[model samples]
Target: MFTLDDLVRLVRDELALPLPVNGAVPDFDHALNWRSVDLVRLVLAVEKHTGHRVPIAELYRRRNLRGVHDLYTATATAAGSADPGSGTRRTAAGSPAAAAGPLPGEGYEDLSLHGWFARSAARHPDALALRVAGQDLSYRALEQAVEHLAGRIAERPGGRPGRLGLLCSRTVSTYAGYLAGLRLGAAVVPLNPEFPPERNTATARAAAVDLLLCTAEDAELAERIGRETGIPHLVLPDTPGPGESADGESADAGRAPGSAPGPDDLAYIIFTSGSTGAPKGVPIKNRHVSAWLSHTVPYFEAGPGSRFSQTCDLSWDLSIWVLFVAWASGAALVVPEKAELLTPVAHINEDAITHWFSVPSSLSMARLLGELTPGALPTLRWSLFGGEPLTVDNARAWQEAAPGGVLSNVYGPTEVTCTCTTYPLPADPADWPDARLGSLPIGPVYPALEWVVIDERGRRSQEGELLVRGPQRFDGYLDPAHNTGRFARWSEDDWAPFEPGEELTDAHWYRTGDRVHTEPDGTLVYLGRVDNQVKIHGFRAEPGDIEAALRRHESVEEAVVVPCVTADGTTELAGFHLGPETDREQLLAFLEKQLPPYLVPRHLVRLPAFPMNFNGKVDRRKLSEEAFDLIARYG
Candidate 1:
């Protein structure tokens, strides 16, 4: 059996802590400041030495060095002279073998987005459906709220709206209003309350929104947007009170309930940042989202008793995944307060969140605040990171924090559905692949989807821009003018630029514009954006490659490399890292050893944190501008 002295030695050697020769170890909670990374290292060391995996959850309960020793001894004693597994044995919960085939209502003639939720409500009416900002609603209660809201929307000046705009945040009204729109056979368009009124107005006008729905807090803003766009506005109550029946509780309740949307009918429209400085609206049909749910609902193994985290805002496409994935699986969707999002570990543990999905940047923020302590998220069973490149270090930190959770890095563009590809990390860290650019490989494309990588020369290759087309891909941009140059055609064994005035069929591929490298086994490693490539001393360079090199340094926690245009019109690479103050000379020397002269950044800046945009992604445009200003001022 592993002794307490052995545990002390392992912790000291793994974490490089100063321990006294008298064999007295300090309490980790009070006497020692141990980071999550340190805890992971110590756990790994103990596992390696003892040959028996220590239960991280139990060790977390006793947050001291002695607790670690006791946990190790107990685990060793339980084995009783027989060698157990070296690592935690993971289940095949999310693998294809675990899938139970089609979900309920899959074969229904008219399958609207809300129809899935209604089916779950019918099957599990007593199940907890939504939890937002300390309020919980059962599936039946939420449906009643949707019905009441639908009746109210039906009595509006223009009657039932064909297209509805949701101007709200993470409030109950926002979620109920979304379902109400679907109940009225209206395509939902989520408008961010945090966004500027002008931007919201533009989006509303572009989508030709017939009505605007919001909570009381956003009533003023919704009214202003309605006035400017000539659309009617309705303020929904914060909670969808119970006892409202979909049959005919209100005078116009039964009259307002519209027919279910067909497979080809529009489900929702999401706007994404466009290169032309205008928001490009991507309209997903009911069938597209249905296809997305069909693949994801079973893959995640979500069902009753599963609690999903709602981290993405309504305006982002990822929120669709957060909402419907839970509803379709009869699981509860948990929305955290703004403050709770920063300290995700506490929220997960306190709420007993079993499924977590958010951008990788969220993990970085928690790591910065030292909230990712080992075994901190014991309730989490599936930890999903998306919307940004997930570094291996962040993956490891989160995995250690939720030792029993399955970690997956998902990837997709708004043009496609929420996600078309996923890479689930191995249960044992030793079997993880060495990613090409220090980010997790976006695993193989979904079996039902089609993908191709076209090189810069417009030929299929093992490395280049990624293009996707399948049931999940949208038909085209809302505006036909924005569709130009956004898609490609495969003809005669080569990809051709989609020309104007050509009929866009299912054969067309949506150009992802993301650069990726295909490994021998067919997995894809994401390289940065294709347009983000810059010329350094007349040699082409990818900022992601340089950023990966900078991240290799032990002192750097996060790294971002941007091309800064100097006053002389020359483009120079500027590197920024988030970590403790390190000698600039040492960073340069470290880069010199691995990178070529031109590949090395000209300037290295240390930042407390990266600026984040509304979607919780790093604001690279802001960083590039800041880098340019620094070069112009310093040079």
Candidate 2:
């Protein structure tokens, strides 16, 4: 039904991108060089032309001339099946490239981000787009800012569909640079200011960053990264520096010539640690972001009057979703004060923020510390929690802190564009402490997405590894070897054959590493990670389960149970706790009563506060490292 030719024509016309209409495939090398944003737009156009949801990696893997044709043919064949692979890769003719099936979202489709932003800007140009430190930028002002920066960017050397690094705090100018980079068709690499110079340098070198943009406050870090990476650096401020004119424009706009990339161009790279030694960069295409925002806006019911907090740093993919998804819906983004970011009570209350998105740890700390309350923060309507599991106790406390708000547990790794599944909060809080958050019911598959659970042997199961496939799912890692190993072919077709009386809709699925089972009602319950299970003295145990149990105890404010290796090289269960009133002996007795002897923690240490990652999760790796040092110091 869907032909590659038709898809190409549709893409050429809709996004106004140049396409090879002669049926001859273009050079893969040249295509790969095209900006990630342009490639994504091209994929979105193909999705629109053919009723198929093209997976992100499928589109990205089309590196050169030969790959594109195979990709198109394969996707075209699988368009209407239960599963659909994008036409970026192909198997030999008559051999299925992926499980054959219709792509997800064969019927309903949401708008693109470009369409939504354009509409919002036209309709509510005067409305607030971002609020930071008591200062606000209206939609009109934001548009002007981006356009002004985009114009200047187009005149620069590395601004045209190349790598541009942005180092700044959570401020409007940082957001502006991001937009400016997008407008110029360059991939935006957001650097973490907190990162040591070495990590920053490593990231810059790995990503092949060519430009660095930093705010005045982060000048030192920016200078360090630039010096190490040899990338040209520019400081932010509307005003130009010495020997420059008042306008922040590059002088040679008229003399320089280059191509202006389209929506399929590369937008940004969100890097995450892979099983591989080096950090793996996930190239996010403009179309991937566009497709995500198109669907994300309506699903969350965001609007001009809505206000969502800026909780995540740009380095984290979560921030991309938090910032743009809300903006696409005309929601005002509120960046709390530097001090308030951890708690964010004053900012939320003062700004009347309607939507709050954070990991469980943030909510827990805020509620436990009495920094947030339901009666005081009545304006809050929705709380979206993700990154890690939301324990029942934390959920109940969060609910009490915002009685009118509903909690949605979102689940996804950086590989998948921020979130692929979400489950709404339960209506009644009756099951509070008893709730075993094994598989957080991370709602149904979003439009154009597919999910599967696999057992230890890779067989499909009601409960197993949570594998995902969707348009939003990212392609393989930046490292080719890592990409090949972790992201591999499941089957020749998009959708696997479904046997009658089976609970899951058979499809080609990506293994999510997490183990989970599906309820009869199709809700997914999360089990712990496959690696989370450990054998102690030939006895199988789950540290997460014990930790969950401990968290339910009234005296234990927070608990982390991890296997620690003692000086004798024997593995022992160790737990670090955060609670002043909770006594170790009493808590240990309570745990002993419920858990087996081996599962009970052999060592318990108290901490005034838990060290957390940016997402607010107790940094288990850090905790483990500290455990080693503590033992060495005290022994």
Location of the lowest summed lDDT over 10 successive residues in candidate 1: 92-101
TM-score of each: 0.81, 0.74
lDDT digits (tens) for residues 561-586 of candidate 2 = 77877779888877777665666788
- Candidate with best TM-score: 1
For residues 466-552, could you state the per-residue lDDT of candidate 1 as single tens digits?
Answer: 999999999999898888888988643776777789888899999988999998887998988998888888899998899888888
What TM-score does candidate 1 reach? 0.81
Q: In model 1, what lDDT does residue 312 have?
A: 73
